[model samples]
Target: MNSFCNVKSVMRSMFSGFIAATVILISTYAIAETTMEKVKRTGVMTAGNSGSYPPFSVMEGKTLLGFDVDLANELGRRMGIKVKFEVIDFKGIIASLKAKRVDTLITAMTKTPGRAKQILFSVPYYDAGLGALTAKGSGILKPEDLTGKIVGVQLGSSGERYVRSTLGKKVKQVKTYDAILLAVQDLKIGRVAAVVNPIPVLRYNSKGAQLVTTPVWKRRAVGINTRKEDADLMAWIDKHLSAMKNEGFLERLDKKWFEG
Candidate 1:
């Protein structure tokens, strides 16, 4: 009877030890699975953006600067990770996301139904719309006036779509150098009649081009782009955006870039 009791006590002790070990292991894995932990483990979060988009993103010398750059840096800081910006064409942004070349896309990408099919978008951090930029002396002012004239636009952009849908096939199309800077150097030199792009981008990039913008479309919400299956990262981004909205960061950024 004494031996049996000792054996039973030993068995109970071993079972309790096993359960405690399992609990600790599970907790450790849960901590490791956190988004913040994952980012830290990777050391840096790769972000995609159209580097030519001024105010939102632009290459100042060799360093990328602008609202999107600052926003991505802030997000990385909050996540306790470093950020590396990968400048990519606008049309290839989503493809890069799928290829895992970048962890997220911080470009001024509009949240459209077609895009939503392939990727998940965070809560909108900015509102933008299609607009036309013409030289100060150019007669073009509205969408209708663009008929039969060469209009420069970034390929695969909403501005391109809007122009195609609104102006039909008769309108002359001039592709810009990239997906962000619709106003190519030639456009300012009379190579193209006018450039169409998101209003905020046009206004931001038009420093001394003697440009005038005509607001021709409603505002579209802009959000961060992530892979569809990255629910953890998506939730983290949504929370961050919500907090920024609540704290007026979004408004502050808009004022700095758009209102100023």
Candidate 2:
């Protein structure tokens, strides 16, 4: 009877140990399987963008075309996965990425300290600076000229940050727009004295939009953004971006989208 009781106790202990080990193993695997593995397993990677920013991302009829679009396709090709884009509003794009509605953000999103806390930014893929656009002959030659004038800027953009932080009390009123293009429209109609946005965007639109792009402000680096937990995906993107830079792919993109 004593031998039988010892045998039963040993069996119970073994079963409990096995259950605990299995639970730990499962938990470990769950932590190890991240977005990188998901992308590889599903054979698809979805990129998020505002879809309104031209030269970077824009909609032509029903099709999306821009530098960011091409870059996303290139990334997918390199990764041997199909790529798709989710056109989220500019203000909501980051939230969409955080919610895992998209695998990455392919918008020309700048890296800011504030944004760094919420998401991971890959190695910079592009560089740009803030530009102030005014109607021709508006007499706004420098930053000081914007004092006491109503200014328009895209909501949640680096341009908005500059206006709020640098031009704070100097400007009369700040008007936020969903799309920078709309702010340009307001500028054309005299709704705002000036529109602050990315230099590349302002330069592209100034050609025949009856607008002038002032000297660019401080430079900002634009990078691919992913959820904080998707560090592996972010690193993977950085590696490919390095390869693209080395092979002059980025230069080609610059020529196609930015250069004259």
Candidate 3:
């Protein structure tokens, strides 16, 4: 009878330990801070952008101005929080985001399969494509004309991917730059035969800049990026962006920046 009582006591102790462990696990999950919750608690949302990309995000005499900046400001207004910008080079922007240096990316980053594997993308906010910028008389009217010529592309961009993957072994050399403007500069000095970047950007930069533009290679969707774990934050951003589109806020921005 004493042995039976001892067994019952041991069972009770084991059961109590299991229950305590389960409670602790539940408590940990309950207290885990989501990205949206942190934003609300701190009253600020940090957004990353390649500030060199113009009409999207750019520096104007020490002030950041552009379509993306305006859009981010509007997002902050709707969230009842202030938005902070982290200007990072396009090459390292994704790494900065994964390291939590910024909460989200508004850098006109295109949605790609490889990037989607590393980060969550909000609903697409814009569409853009690759185009070549060459000297006015360079005779590089299309992608085919780029064979055996040195080309410049922004590092980590779809244009770079296309050149390396599609034009591999055809081009003499592929030069990379931190910014598209740098690539364009190289093209101007004959350092590179052509510079590839977003078609809209090429058009914007080529205006009276003595550069010739090529037809677009392909158009892709651009979306905001966040850490994969921040589903709630992603949902919040998508909801607001959808609302902005529906309300014609996005159309006005297009007219002000892209069309105007």
Candidate 4:
């Protein structure tokens, strides 16, 4: 009888432990379901972009459209979500992502070593080099011509970094606007002798402006940005961009925006 009693007690304790384990598993699964369900239920993925940047993002009257916008829409379609564009300043894009104001940032942002620490970047979707645009017939022909000249750049951009690093203390730096177009405008008015920006952006925004470009530096990759810990979303975006590159979708978009 004593042996039977001991056996029964052990059985009861084992059953209780099994029940607790089951409860924990169920709770974990419930939490995961809740997190993933929000994305599908909402049906819209909010994307942050600097709409003032041409070729990558811009406002065509009331409609927001450009390479980044199209790419965001394509990503949403692949993810089975509708896309909602939120135009934000370039300088504040990372802040907005951290604050959860947008799901992702698909602006023409370079994948730099410093930014990699703060945000998760999807696989590179494009490659661009740093370049300077000067008024046509202006004496500034090469990177060296920028010496001792006032150069305008978008605040907090790689363009500014390139100029500072390359020109050292000779070039006067001006942070006029978040958009490269404004800097180009300043260049036209002789406020700044040259405007430094991504080669594609400067070309896209230069319409009727007497602008000529000289390559200053190279950026190895450009990528979409998402908040840290968004691993699933980042993985999905990486796969999607990879497919776009493989299927020639990216090339088509590039030609339409950059070559055309």
lDDT leader: 2
Sorted by TM-score (best first), the order is 2, 3, 4, 1
Model 4: weakest 10-residue lDDT segment is 30-39
* Deviating ranges (above 4 Å) for candidate 1: 1-37, 137-139, 179-184
Tens digit per residue, CA lDDT, model 4, 110-147 = 98777899998888888887788888888786777887
Instruction: At residue 204, give the lDDT of candidate 4.
Output: 77
- Which candidate, 1 or 4, has the higher lDDT? 4
- Alpha-carbon shift of residue 39 in model 3 (angstroms): 0.8
Q: Estimate each model's TM-score.
A: 0.79, 0.86, 0.84, 0.81
lDDT of 2: 0.89
Which digits, one per residue and each the tens of the lDDT, describe model 3 over residues 226-252?
A: 999999999988999989888888889
Best by TM-score: 2
Which 10 consecutive positions of candidate 1 have the poorest summed lDDT?
174-183
Whole-model lDDT per candidate:
0.79, 0.89, 0.87, 0.82
| Model 2 residue 221 distance off true place after TM-score fit, in angstroms | 0.5
TM-score of 4: 0.81
